[model samples]
Target: MPTPGSTQRKFRLADDALWAEYDQACRDINGSTDRSDDIRKHVEAVVAEWKQRHKMN
Candidate 1:
């Protein structure tokens, strides 16, 4: 679990291409604002969807 504002320090991307794509997606969705927050929200949505699909939560 990560506390608020700790995401940037905790999450890391090893692949430059993946990071670039993620950054571009974030910018496309958020218009160059709150990229980190958008990424966090995107990750949370994916997790939530996965959990719901798996009936884990």
Candidate 2:
């Protein structure tokens, strides 16, 4: 079995992956068109959601 610290690290990595995916999606969407205020707001929302999930603040 994994140690408690390792379990926490795994959870953190999963959260990081979620953020990375969101960033990649933002880049992909931005690449297909011009950056708009709505897109920026969407990215901010995604980041906020990730931070909340990870208890980062």
lDDT on C-alpha atoms for all candidate structures: 0.76, 0.62
Q: Per-residue alpha-carbon lDDT of model 2 for 1-57, expressed as tens digits?
A: 445665321223458777667667767976533334445576899999999989964
Once model 1 is optimally superposed onto the true structure by TM-score, how far is the C-alpha of residue 13 displaced, in angstroms? Answer: 1.2
Least lDDT summed over 10 consecutive residues: which range in candidate 2? 5-14
Question: TM-score winner among the candidates?
Answer: 1
TM-score of each: 0.48, 0.36
Winning model by lDDT: 1
Among residues 3 or more apart in sequence or in different chains, the pairs in candidate 2 whose N, CA or C atoms overlap within 3 Å are none
Decoy 1 TM-score against native: 0.48
Please, what are the lDDT tens digits per residue for candidate 1 over residues 14-49? 999988887787788778856668766879999989
